[model samples]
Target: MLIDTHSHIYTEDFSEDIADVIQRAYENEVRKIVLPNIDSSSVKKMLNLTEQYPQICYPLMGLHPTSVTEDYEDELQLVEFWLQKQKFYGIGEIGIDLYWDKTFIKEQTDAFRRQIRLAVKYDLPIVVHFRESFDEVITVLKEEMQPGLTGVFHSFSGTLEQAQQVVELGFMLGVNGVVTFKNSGMDKVIEKVDPSHIILETDSPYLTPVPFRGKRNESSYLVYVAQKVAELHQISVHELARLSSNNAERLFRI
Candidate 1:
């Protein structure tokens, strides 16, 4: 069985053929998918998707870093409200993102920290989104790292040192289609990290794998990522799938 740890199938991009997309995923051996909420606007859609496919789709509630802004406090409140009323699997798609716009940097940090505290309070794993702010994210995690403060660094694109730091902090590095890109340095770093500390994801409708690069990605394409990891470790695709899927199941308690 395969588990796509991060995917935004709720995005309008798949609204026209969501059932077909999901069917493709199952046909390709993807047994479970975890949908991470972006913000207040996406919460309802995410919940509805989970309701439609409860056995296969699990929902996570949290404020995405990029969604943080001057009015972030209100958004955080909304996240908290939903989290309190539901049994979400985790608290995430949260972290710091300075790639798109750094105007709300401070607000993003505050919101990330607040959400981290919430994860601790609720005893849930965090799915982090770090972009051009690895140092800052590591610093926060270092200060907050403790028993029960574990999570995955989603779409990890950092150095071996950074990956080591994250592992040291009790977090898994979320490997995705980026690992299949020829230009991505993930190949080198992933060679050093243990597969036990890694999880597979497609981040579908976003980072499609090679041969399908620049096109719409989907959960079914996760096999390409599995193939790449197998080649890197000189193992078979089945072994990579088993190890990676096991890692995801352990981390997410699926």
Candidate 2:
């Protein structure tokens, strides 16, 4: 069995065929999928999907970095409200993203820090998303580092040095479809890292693996990523699946 540590299939992108998507993922041996919230507006939708697929889908509550706006404080309240009201596998789909916009850098940073504290308080792992702001994210994590605080860097496409740094921080690197891209250079970086410091994800509805590049990604495609990473690590796909799924299970307690 495999666990897709990060995915957004609850979104409207998969609305038309979500059942089929889950079926395909299960059929492909991709059993558990972690669903991270985008913002306050997404909480209901995400939770509803979890209710429907209680066995296959796990929910995470948080406001994504890109969703950090002037009114983000309100969003955080909603996140906290849900956290107190229910059981969540983790605090996630959270972190700093500078690739899309930089106008709310300060707000984004503050939100990231606050959410990290929430994760600590809740005793749950965090699913981080860092794009063009690795240094900033790492700085905050270093500041907040404490016993029992850990998570994965979702969609990690960084250097071996960076990968080592993340592992040293007690966090796993989330490898996705990007590893299969010929020029992404992720395969080379992953080659040097041990499987113990890695977990598999698809970031579905985006970053579709090769052979299906340019098409909408789904949990089923995680098999493609597993196959490629297994080849890179010189291991069988079954072993890779076991290792990555075990890492995810420990991190999210799912």
> Backbone collision count in every prediction?
0, 0
For all the candidates, what are their Cα RMSDs to the real structure?
A: 0.8, 0.6
Candidate 1 TM-score, C-alpha based? 0.98
Top lDDT: which candidate number? 2
Can you list the residue pairs that collide in candidate 2?
Answer: none
At residue 34, candidate 1 shows an lDDT of 92
Tens digit per residue, CA lDDT, model 1, 61-174: 999988988889999999999998988999988999999999999999888899999999988899999999999988888877768789999999999999998898889999
- In model 1, what are the clashing residue pairs, if there are any? none
Q: What TM-score would you give candidate 2 relative to the actual structure?
A: 0.99
Candidate 2 C-alpha lDDT tens digits along 61-125: 99999999999999999999999999999998899999999999999999999999999999999
Give candidate 1 regions above 4 Å deviation.
Answer: none
